[model samples]
Target chain A: MKIINFILFPFLFSISTFAAPTWYPMPAEAYKFGQLYPKAQQLLFAFDYGHALVYERLLQNRGLITDPKEFEKKILDAVMKILKNPPTVKVDEDDIAPLYVYTFPLMVDTFDWSHMLHQFVLDVLATSKDRGPAMNRRVNELFIDYKKNKPLAITDVCKTMLFMDGQFFSKDFRRQYPSFNLLIWSYHWFQIKLYEALLKPTKAERDIAVDQVTNDFWTLISDLPDSADFDMMPETRKEAPNFYKAFPLISASFDNNHMLHDIVSDILASKKVPSSEMRKNGIDFARMAMDPEAFKSNNCGAE
Target chain B: MKFLALAVLLCSQMLFANQKAILVNASPNAQFYRDLILKVRQSGEFTLPIPGAQSSLTYSFDFDQPVFPETLMGDIHDSFNPIYFFRSFWDKILFKDGSYLLINGEKLPLTCLFVSGQDNRFSDKKLLSPLLPEFVLKVYLVANDFSCQGPVKPGWPATGGREENWDTYLYYEIKDPTIMLPMDAKLRYRWNEYSLVLVDRGSK
Candidate 1:
């Protein structure tokens, strides 16, 4: 037994020594405002569920509803249930959206990376007493750090609808399923609008703004695809002007992120792109979105 | 005996390298960071178990690399390659698997669970300016005690910085000539108050 113990020790030790992949936690001070801003935090978590659930359903064709209206109603109903009682912890998106994750791993990575930045930015605003120089510097530094992951980071440069809608595969998802498309836009809308709310000078005022924004989001989705609240996708510049003005780089990044979401959905939904080529087209679309040199189009602002 | 020796040899060849740690000290602009570092420096002497037995350990890190915090945030890839962002500084400590610290003639054991790094240079060149001028790196020593029960509860103190993981924060900003990075550190031994400390060599 002693001989066996001695023989196995070094091998066991070496086996344990091999490097296992581990992730860095958000900055030491991150998520400080979780308790302070439950409503916003919970909503963000729900939005995550909504994204994962929709992509999985769309990409996998789980229910196989042929009619567009039926698909819209079923998806919207399920998503609303999730939003009503959102998961406490972040949904492990891979588990929910396996096909989408498998099809476009890099695209999913880009979204997750940018979404983390979004959460961190909100925390920065929520934890700080006021939107002062310190807050501005922190936000700027976060943005600077956010672009470090070259393959995954979305370029903050404003992309034209030409890149998003002009492609042959573009607009298929929205055309086929307007309600789900609009639901995603509403998610983007509430995200930026919440930023605008958090930017209010005082806590008392900020609280009120949050409630108002939440109420407005509920109102916007009261009716399904036919809801008259907003026919067009909400742009950051239009929806959260204050947040956009205060942090232009972040605002542009949000717009770019939303555009990428639309682009990916369109690619997946379009039958023009063969199944074998969906992965390739997705990569090209993502690369175009990440390219900083792509010139902007004035006509591309969320209509 | 021969078989045991061959197994040992194979293990040594395949396993980790014993790399010496070099710490750099960079000052922080954030007030929360400043406070966390200050508290650790003032705490004086404490001991922790390394690989084998209890030993005194002192930590000194220099984070003076020009890398911004946001850049570190970007480096976090949720999938396979997650450790690149913390490798620069944390790897140094990792290389020294079991170490000791003596602060003011008291023995303390220094233990670390994780380190991560982020570098912007690994990104696309087209996005960078001709005079990129600045190359920045940030590394973290997240000494989280996993023993803390339940998930991280949301309602933490609003005004101060909260460690994402469990308690007992120990930060050190070492100006050690041997380890040459510029980083300011903070260590908090939380019964729940936020503070940071700096170690000037083993002299405390």
Candidate 2:
């Protein structure tokens, strides 16, 4: 009995040693930063839920693209309901999967890496002291540090737009999934605009900017397929040109992140690949086809 | 002129950079605490096992350089990692596992910790991010009756800037000059104060 147990220990140890994937998280304080940008945070929260639902819907047998009616019934209608009443908190992504590991095992981590930076910039703005010192310096400093963090970092801006424009990827997903696509574009619009708003001097002012952005989100989202928001994903460089001017890498990184999100959805909705491999293949397409490891972006008022 | 401004900045940092820590021996009931410390080391995944908590803790990587982020907002860990100590002390406990004091139901003297770090660099490249110019967190395992050998001594007067206290508070000191990356001037590097500590302000 002892000999049998001893021999089995090695095998058990090797199997047990298999490492599990983990989420990339923002600094603890980033969560507290939500207080300053409640609406944007809520939208960000909704985006988390939206990602899971959209992915799960795409995984549905034959999905909507195969039968346009089911797509409207299952995907479009649900998004409209969500727009009317959004979630208040960022969701626990683990519960979203009816089937554990439905998306690529790394999907949650990949989103989390970009999400952490998203919140990190918010925290920098949120933490700025009134009239104490310029925050740009610190914001810029932290941005550089954030990129240095890997396994915890999603890629920065890709040099090319072809990844989002390729055969497997294009406007088809959004064209088909308008409401959900609009919802995601709404998330990016405010997320990018908030950077511009954060450059405001005070939280009260920032609060007002957030409200305006929120209103802008609703205005655009309500316009449906013809909405102005659907024209293009929010370009950080164009929307918050000063921020983009200062920290092109982080701005580009964030823009790339949103672009990839859309691109991956396109790949999934197209259903060219097997449902099981959709997410895995999509992630591969994102990293390999669109390499943004070189440029991360963020801007504190100073260097 | 620049020297004077720099001096004031440094002086102010010296006065307030107090990341005080309390190292309680792992008593019998605290066996879980001891084992956890042993499991995490030299900067890996860290989640403080706040009993009955539903979420994990995350580090903000304080960016103020010599200063740390706010650790506690009240009775909660505002934004900081759990006890980070040196890897060398992974097996250096002095108390029997599971032996700890309970004061009003709160576990006394939490698990031992050792932070390895260095002087905050002022160079342009090094100043990019918090994690860029920082060290790692290690754990210390000791048996019962093991008092902390780290810079922070129990019941030391607060804010005096003693050699041991300041060094521990700021997280620096050299045990081995040869192997200096971990030490490079970092031991007990500044971390957010995750727990509340009562200040004794000299009898009012």
Candidate 3:
């Protein structure tokens, strides 16, 4: 083990020393949705912090959680604290989890790629006029262009069965970390709900709808859900039904991605894995989830 | 096009109003501000730079418009320069921070300042707001900063991804009357790279 660490330490340092520039073409509708409804974006701003902070805290305090649920509670408290006054700008993720990157470099890239999809949808909806026909074309164009670059696209199928409490899954992560998991679920709950706003034609109508959704998000955060209670991961088909009709494949991918959000968290927080091997375990789960046959789901059961 | 004329008109109006209403112990050129505001309001692009020491900070702005997207650094040129660039933050870290803030003295309630910036292309621990007067400022919107970060990632269109460290901020500038405010409508640093694209999100 010592020898392996010595061999890999320099590699990590060098990779960090000379990294590639990360950027993307801002979708044509970059900040338009936010301009249309500032509060909606603010909600997302809070989630960005929550999302990154979760990975940071989990990795920072790996193996400390003998009581996963209790730890999840603490994490929720932290997320709510952040939601109260989210940072006005994005914080450096690499800065947040520098040491962890030495091990889980792949997770960082996958997270960034998935995040771009989230922002891309908001952009598409921003340009799409209240779920009009143009919505389909714009979304398709973006999906095609985005897929062309792939941007670390999660092509494999990470089925719901993988997340089941089998031998691989344990009580430590999910049973202990319910609220934190729910917080993520809740973050996603609103992610799909955001599309409903597009159904409204004008800015004022969209604003009113977005405000309602924003209010809905705050309700969830302020009244944290019961521990280990993600209440079943949100499905794009169920949440974004209109979108489901338009882009079934893409929509399924998002639901799969959301499920993996939990899967990764589950594995990271599990008591089954030793603290030292958590990164390796996370990568394993990431790989399995990336496997198209395993991760991709055309239908995650009717319900 | 009309903002300059409106600015001049607003200055004159402030002068007129301040002289006419002597009830509040008005400052010497009290009317200049009101006139400038009215003129700006009259002229269409109702963007105003915060006056005083902080007002001098360089700024570059890009509205979320529909058009071809370009890297912020790419878009920035001789005619359009942001008040603070990536290097500006670094320079401040090494030397004295160049950002100016005279708001403690009474100025029109500071509200929502939207700054367009970049993120870390490399290692930089400098977080601008964490070091500033945090109590006085409330940050509501921060993107491009967090969304684009971490290991070998692909770039996207319109932005210089994680490598560029491009970010944005919308802060609520508190209105304090104690501050000695500017009389003219020029709301940018001395270099003045771009016209202020600031909008009134609301006042503090």
Candidate 4:
């Protein structure tokens, strides 16, 4: 019996030992980024957190915050602070604060989506060198479509616009005040604009162009800290700068439409008692603001 | 009693003395002309050009589904490239000479061909084809900077040591095509940073 057991044991062990081998071809040392060009990968990672923070704050305070506009303001202010000081490491599961647990899942999901979108942008830019204007225009169209189709009122538009309006107002006031809708729009616009700038000219030229745009973007944000409305205003082709001339109308329309979406989302998301019993007043407002014909005609010109 | 045992052993050995060769041609027509003949020669198990043998051996090939990482489907929207995201966890074997063996004039997928090398006489019969030997070659595509030695093993799982350092056993048999004679072959492969060594059984 012991002899039989020994023979069977060796056979069983031999059968179990035949495991497949694995290989890791790419190593960590191969991954490197030069200092001159911005680290788009790292920036995209940071942007992910900024978007999450706003979304979490919005969802957590959804019912508690009585005033939608006021909530938007606070969230936008938070976004501005994040842009000013982005986090270093990726947000881990444990890093989610107690107040943000409810919205954390949604934020995590959106981060995945945003990361894919960032990759898509990189792929598109990498492929087309000379079509900067067309690509930028296409990106703008995609953003508009995203807003109209799958709009996230609190995070996508409001916080984005606030981040873009960094240099316009005093840093303190900008940090204090939040305009959630405008922040989303402005951030997206700047991101797309950066892509456009990077796609054109010689490497040196592109670098200079991005620096100038970055400076201009910061300056514009700094000048108008309280409101993104001024930033969204239309300028004649002659008055506008070289790159801005190509899509002045579209840019202006996007800014205003985004703000309108923000206000509507705020109203819908807010806890204030509605004048009407029907829960769709905010939706109705969004539809009116998002109307393409009205947008072409500058219907929200007064605001 | 000893004479009886010896007679029984001699009879058994004589019964298995007749050997048969069956060819499985899986190579492309272009490569077949060049490689098939060479492989047979290098294998040293069989002789070619039997009087009654068919011109080409028949075989079929089938592919198995690739194994992917468990996290792939859920994380489709993540930034990482989906192709390299999953580790390669499986190996598939295909006939070097891309063809299937004909058993009684019917082609069968090349899964495992059972061959008896004890037969001393060669037969064209499809059932009498000898089994082909198999070799397991362990390989690691090491990164440039990393080394096979020291505290950090170059090609190892983060928490575990080198996978190639693990023990593996290979079983093979060599046979004389003219007369059935089984030559037992055992082998093992050990890989370090520079190259892989294919060692015979019992060699450290």
Candidate 5:
């Protein structure tokens, strides 16, 4: 009896201590639109990898320099090649940025899940013929599923830019790497604009608008710091008003995700943040991003 | 004593119920699966290889479904999971850990392996999504034991059998002509390269 008790106690303890892995399977309809617009999908995939590469380089201090322009030329050149010939599928970020992934898996997971939501919305728009209420209903369902994994979900509540820029280490990444910063904003600009393009009534219009948007995106980043949207990160409300009016929750979530992206870059690039504290800071900021109470009291709808 | 035994049985059953894989079943929930398949067909993303093979392989993707992380990985490694195979996770570990898979009774020799990629550009001129059938399959017999050696781990079978190869590569894919996702997708089996197609058991 005593021997059995000892063995059982240890077995149960081991089982209890193990952290169960959790992930949600994407809906079947999600990847259908990806087929229709392979180019757009590929670019999105490239953007995903670009984000990882920047974070990894910043955090690992790999080829990092004091001069932002030199660093941008080097990194952006590599990134441009990827954009030219982007991957067909999702890039395993950990492979590209192991330290970043393992250091802040939660934050990384949050971003990945939000990215999935981004794809979900695209799928909803691309697949559904009925662009009005039916599309909204499907997107609403996807949003619910997006929120299923609470730890991985970014809050839909709109937080002001102050939450992002107010921190001590907030604007350092952008200030130091202005061109590189603009490049990321350009990526965000295209992401939101694609939704606007997809919102066009006809497939012909959508195709032309998407191409125009893609061309515009390239134009925006052509000269780097000079032509970029340096005034602010692309807000979904302004860049994609149709999408915003249709689904404020998803739009806010995208806005929050973009905000988190900046916050993460700032944390990684800030010299004020100790190397060891970067992960902690990243996680702390992620929690603040996920906090619903951080919503605008009356100014929520202002932005 | 009887009450205690019944109580324990009920508790275990409840736990088992919670872990059950949500797949094709005769429940009303099956409607969700039907709608998905319809959407796939409507989008022209996938189709049955044979017109009458409706029962071939159907998958229900409940995005909100709670799945144990290992279960997802297990589906990929099981060699018989289903129509869709995600290889992104496996590719990361494949070179480091080495992989062994049994497809159509052939025990893949673990040596230097290079899985050949399909040409995404087709004569139809339509660019297909990488998440389709062909892209999903990772088991092209390009060069087995070709100029490379992988680390062999201990307690790994000195003998042969499907069960013994614990680190099996994810296998199985849609029979429809077009598909590919960089690393995540299905395993398409070529009859000339191998024999027999195994339905993904995980889908059941």
Candidate 6:
């Protein structure tokens, strides 16, 4: 019996390992970034925090942490502050730990890459003036080097670029939870637009614009419910089509990206709702969006 | 010996009886859509095989029921993939699976399935007259299997941008086949979309 058990255990383990699902990139258009800039990284992080805060609130509520609203408010405040005053260095160790636990392996070691990319962009842009022709030549060389070393596939690159265009959707994330996915996408767009405003050459104008936008974006997102109301799925989508329309390439890459965001939020917010319930809710929302007859019958805000 | 034989026959019958089915419904409200699925399952209109079946199931929905003209169905298909207009960041997650189930009879070649509620809203109901039969509850079993990793996480310099991962499966089902309408009429209706992919064993 012991011998049989040992053999079965290993075989079972192997089956489990193999059964684990794997994720892949969607298309080349998903990863294009015309110009990598410092503010872009900040914008991305701000969006991340926005998503994180939502999940954090949900998880805290689930954990019996009273006053999730307070924590949510604090996190939103922090996000606003960051938007106003972007972080200079990569995220602090403490912040990374929470994010790591929430996002897990995907977020692991990613900050370093983001920081490196930002620094590289800053260095190149700073030299563009002094180096003139040399700067231009060096920029081309850097692009080539980055492509070769950290080469994102055409689809990946296009997805990134498409983010800039603000119209294309990410196929992967969109497939799983369209509402939450759109919320995150909208957050990204808000950040991108804010970054563009802040990156303007005039420092004074940038600062003022950043503060205004940050305040407005926070107010907009804060108005959203802590948990997704499954009944209101279509109404939410109709009201926020631009948010959905904005990030197609990135959305296509993974279903779990959006799922995890909600999962972690549920955990952090201490929402008692089971993961299965959340998943089912997401699936139903997806079906409603796919059915043409249903779409026509339902009013998504527009008459 | 006779009792033993009867027991074996009964066990075999039970084994063969095991079945699995997935039903998906969509609404403008995410919470409502979720509840609708639960309601449908509880209502027992469909029987799901226990011990789970070897095969997988999927369901999909579209929330934005963009109304297109019946006259332009051919033009829309000839010029571009109309799906692109409705495509958004949220749509990516649904396509993680290679294919999806079609609720209507409409035969969709692409992996994704489109649904909308807007069809019932049109004043001129005749627009959907041509394809009404094909548009009701239909199912499509995909011939190919495609697998991929989740998207790379968007970076956040403040917390070190994190990457995320997920596994997805796509399948389709046709719910109503009697409703036939022109391609343009079909595209004109708006509906909320949703989908379900069979998670591999132990995925939960």
Top candidate on DockQ is 5
Classify candidate 4 by CAPRI docking class: incorrect
> What does DockQ come to for candidate 6?
0.01
Q: What does candidate 5's lDDT look like per residue over A1-303, in tens digits?
A: 232233223322222111322234657677666777888888887887688877876765633455666666777777777787777655456535555776676778788778877887887788788968887898899899889888878888888888788888888888888888898999999989988898888889988988898889889988888988569888999989988888888888899999989988888888888877877887888888888777443466564
DockQ of each: 0.01, 0.01, 0.02, 0.01, 0.04, 0.01
Considering only chain B, report the TM-score of each candidate against the true chain B.
0.32, 0.20, 0.16, 0.17, 0.23, 0.20
B77-137 per-residue lDDT for model 5 (tens digits): 1122222222221111112223333433454543222222222122121223343222222
lDDT of each: 0.57, 0.48, 0.48, 0.34, 0.58, 0.30
A1-303 per-residue lDDT for model 2 (tens digits): 232233223422222111333224534445555565555775666666567666655654344355554564565566555555555434344434332233555554556556766777777777677423456666666666666656545555444555566555477777777766776777787788878887777778877877887788778777665675456676777788766765676886787777767776776667566676766775675455234443322332232
Model 3, residue B14: distance off in Å is 12
Candidates 3 and 5 compared: the better one by lDDT is: 5
For candidate 5 chain B, which ten residues in a row score worst on lDDT? B39-48
**Candidate 5: CAPRI quality band:** incorrect
lDDT of 3 by residue, A242-261 (tens): 66766766766666667667
Better of 2 and 5 by TM-score: 5
Compose the digit string of candidate 1's lDDT tens values, residues B1-204: 999999997766443222111111121223323222222222233333234654343553222222223212222221222211121222212213233334435433433323233222322322222112112222233333323221233454553455354454444233211122223333444435332222121110
TM-score on alpha carbons, each prediction: 0.54, 0.51, 0.56, 0.33, 0.60, 0.27
| Per-residue alpha-carbon lDDT of candidate 3 for residues B1-204, written as tens digits (9 for 90 to 100) | 599999997887676556434522322232333222121111111233344423222222222221112212211111111121121010000001222222124222111122122122111222222112111111112223222231123454355544423233223221111111111122322223333322211111
Residue A205, model 3, lDDT = 81
Deviation in angstroms for B59 in model 4? 64
Candidate maximizing lDDT: 5
Please state every model's RMSD to the true fold in angstroms: 23.8, 19.3, 19.1, 28.3, 18.5, 28.2
Better of 2 and 6 by TM-score: 2
